[model samples]
Target: MPELPEVETVRKGLEQLVLNKKIKEVLVAWDRIIERPNIEDFTNQLIGEKIDSVSRRGKYLIFHLTHYDMISHLRMEGKFDYVQPDTSVTKHTHVRFIFTDHTELRYLDVRKFGRLTLLPKNTAMDYKGIKKLGPEPTPEEFLLESFNQQLKKHHKAIKPLLLDQTLITGLGNIYVDEALFKAKIHPEQTANTLTFDEVTRLHVAIINVLAQAVEAGGTTIRSYKNALGEAGTFQVNLMVYGKTGEPCPNCGTEITKIKVAQRGTHFCSLCQRIHL
Candidate 1:
């Protein structure tokens, strides 16, 4: 799963190359990828609309168009490629946008799990999934006090609650495990049972992990790449994400892997201990 940094990297690349480009036509090769209003309606809403801006909310990319907003989720293997007008369409390229300038914006997804939704212009922020999302980790609204309040509101294990998009958008299994490990908090520990100091440490871990991941263009564990198809560099800096049995870089403790929320979780038992 591409988290905040990976999604943000895609957004930045696509924004620079595709923003202000007028849409000449839209091609939907895979009908299932179109999730809202049907494929015909999807193409109708996007064709001839100029892209005003490209932004990100959680892990979804938001393309602000002239009349409507085109939101896309690059779930797992989805990627956008910018090509010239004469470029040949490759296999697995499910969506293509022909620009007035003779360029192509192609969305390729091997797993075919990516989704596209078109909402009306001047749409309210509370539209469907957007309505349910909590504060962005990087946004000014996600302060330590607000984070503590959110933590106290949930009695479940801290790991799964952090993974909840309603509490904090874009956190996935990898980032959640890494953040908790950095804070020395056990993944299965109850959220509201955390001490004040643990809460403060968690706040710092979330911010630091996200900010650093962005700096490295995101952690590419598998097929993740930028708009240009370049692998991320953060995987080299990871301490506990995928290092299951490896020794921890900080304390030399052997890292361990467990399943939490049905997701593979990696942490250091010596670092993140649970009394329960």
Candidate 2:
């Protein structure tokens, strides 16, 4: 699944590739991928609509059209490719938006788990998926005090708490592990038990890690690519997420891997001491 940074990268690519282009037609090869309205209605509504801009919230991509906002979630293996009208469609190509200029924006998903829903203009936030997401970690609204207050209310382990989209949007297993490791906070520590100083360090770590990941175009653990079909480079800078049994960068101790909140979690056990 694409995290916040991956989604942002795709948003940027789509803005460059598809912005202002009027849709000549919308072709749905797999009807199930359209989550809102009947397939016939969806196909008819999108025709002749112009893609004004592209934006992202959490892991969802928002395509702002003249008449509607198309919300797309690239769950797991969903990807978008931009090509000329003459380009051949692959077997996995589920949705195709043929632009007026004879170009195409194609959505391909190997797992077919990606979703697309249309909401009326300026009403995308009312959609259930967008309404519940917490403030984006990259923005000024995600203050340290707010983060501290939210942490105090959760008894769950820090790892799973951070993964909650309702608390803080856009953090997944990879960046959570990286942030916790960087802050030297044990993933198993109860959320409310964190000290003010610890929380401050963690807050900074989360912002820095996510910002760096976005700058690096997000980490491509497996088959993740931007809208331009370019793989991410941040994986090379990863410290402990997938470095199981490898020596910790800060300390020589081997990095440990454990199942935390049903997700594979990596950490430098000696470095991130439990502070209760």
Can you tell me which runs of candidate 2 are displaced by over 4 Å?
none
- The lDDT for every candidate, in the order shown, is 0.86, 0.92
- Against the hidden true structure, what lDDT does model 2 obtain? 0.92
- List the lowest-lDDT window of 10 residues for candidate 2: 137-146
lDDT of 2 by residue, 1-276 (tens): 799989999999998899899999999999999999899999999999999999888999999999899999998889999998799989999999999999999999999999999989988888899899998986496889888999999888999989988878999999999999999999999999999999999988988999999999999987899998888899999999999999999998999999998999999989998876
lDDT at 115, model 1: 87
Please, what are the lDDT tens digits per residue for candidate 1 over residues 1-276?
Answer: 788899999888887798899988899999989888788888877878998998888888888899998788888888999998789889999999999998999999999999888888757264677778888887485688888887887789999898878878878888888899889999999999998899999988888898889889998887788987778898887889889889988889999998998988898988899955
